[model samples]
Target: MSTGQVLDQVMDIDEVDLTVDTEVDVNCISKHRSKVHQHFTKIENKFQCNHCKKTFNIEKYGCTSNRLKHLNSKHPSKVEKDQTHALTQKNVILQAFQKQQKNQSEADLQRLITRFIILTDQPFVITEAQSFFELMAFGKTNAPAIPSADTIRRKIFAVYDEEKLKISQKLQSAPGKISLGADCWTAATGKSFHGILASWIDADWNFQQVGLDFDILNGNHKGKSLAASMFKVMNEYGIASKLMAITTDNASNTDTMFLELQKILSEN
Candidate 1:
């Protein structure tokens, strides 16, 4: 054939191929776009699957192929639902997950509130205050309701007991004897009380101090009375045998208290 005829044939074939390619692309775009979008949401520039919440980049992938592939492989049944139904289903699933997470965090949140109250010296009734509720709501939109004041008091005692047990165990396992400190004072309410603290060196050679007791001392703050109160705390913690030294103010009664403690120790 002559060159012009050959060139004409080549041009005709190229035109047919281009037309077929263009038609196929248009068909794919029209048919797959709605189907793919049914199970996915376009957020910003990414398509996130409603069922799985997996995001596909719109810039790199042009929004349909990756999403369709994700639907077919990961969520085959979800692709058949209409757009509105799929979106509602996604919201339901997400809400359920968030609710479950919130429920799980409630105990932790309560403990944190207890710690906050203790650290701030706030009254337990603070939990019942509307201002506190507003503060909590301001911090978290779905914050759990604050427990009643009585409930908070019980939690405080429970935490105290748990920590006391832990401290008792630590004192029991201490490598060295525990040093005891005691002070007798009258509270603002004119109630006499004895406060006892314990200091010890741990197996790790770390010095640890813990408040052991702050019990009401009904009678006099004399030597024998203070000795008995301090020893009671030591016996309660199972640490009377681990006493290294007693520390107190240089009152004449403190000397007698030490003598009384020695007599008691010798007798025990």
Candidate 2:
């Protein structure tokens, strides 16, 4: 909208005095390369003007419309070149997005592979199978290649340890005393298993529960066996001092288990 002679020099954005009353935050722009800022950035739809420091909601008025109005009125030459500059920058931004997307896709692959292994009871080495690679390759995912079985295994263990730590902290930080529920059963394979879970309200008053232990019972389901397993979980999370009550089905052994637990908790 400027005069022809001044507009002719619009090609060089570097000359524009893009200075503001206050500096514009990098987040004030979409995740695109900015000629003026020259940084990777993304902003909320509502942004404050860099020159005026006035707040505007891009969604209510329109995304980028306020920006355009400012550019056209204050720096028409810059506006004249914005479309071309944005076009030139598009390819560069796209390449960056592609690279980021590929990495995220690969991480998702690791999680999916872990879930598949657990749910299907498949061996850890199944990841190295040729059919898995072929199936994933045909899906056209951005993941560059199928991870080796060992890589998937490492990822699974890393994720498990991280989650375990989080659960431990949550139990230790329970807003109130925590309650426990436990169960024991023998599987069709004739292997005995026992599991324990903790339940408590969070600081925000939201009830939450998480399994603290699920392990094979190598010995008979005696009171001593149950007490040992329960003690292990409580000790791991340091929740013995915070335990409010323990719940179990009407089993004779469970009654004995509580008596044994009381002795252990008292001695500690």
In candidate 2, what are the lDDT values of residues 1-268, reduced to their tens digit?
2223333443344433223223354344333233433311224654555554555654442334456666568767765586677666554454554555565666676788887886787888887888877887663535565677798778778877888999988887787999999999989888888999999999999989889889788777898889988998899889998999999999999989999998998998
For model 1, the stretches where C-alpha displacement exceeds 4 angstroms are 1-105, 139-143, 259-268
Q: What are the TM-scores, per candidate, against the unseen true structure? A: 0.57, 0.55
RMSD of 2: 17.3
Q: How many residue pairs collide in each prediction?
A: 0, 0
Cα lDDT of model 1 by residue, 1-268, tens digit: 4434433443322111112223234433333325565566667656677787877765544436766677778876666554566566555555554555576466787898889887888899998999988887763545566787897898899988998999999999998899988888887888888899999888988889989999888776788888888778888899988888888888888888888988887887
Please list all clashing residue pairs in model 2, or write none if there are none: none
- Overall local distance difference test of candidate 1: 0.73
Residue 225 miss distance in model 2 (angstroms): 0.9
> Candidate 2: global Cα-lDDT?
0.71
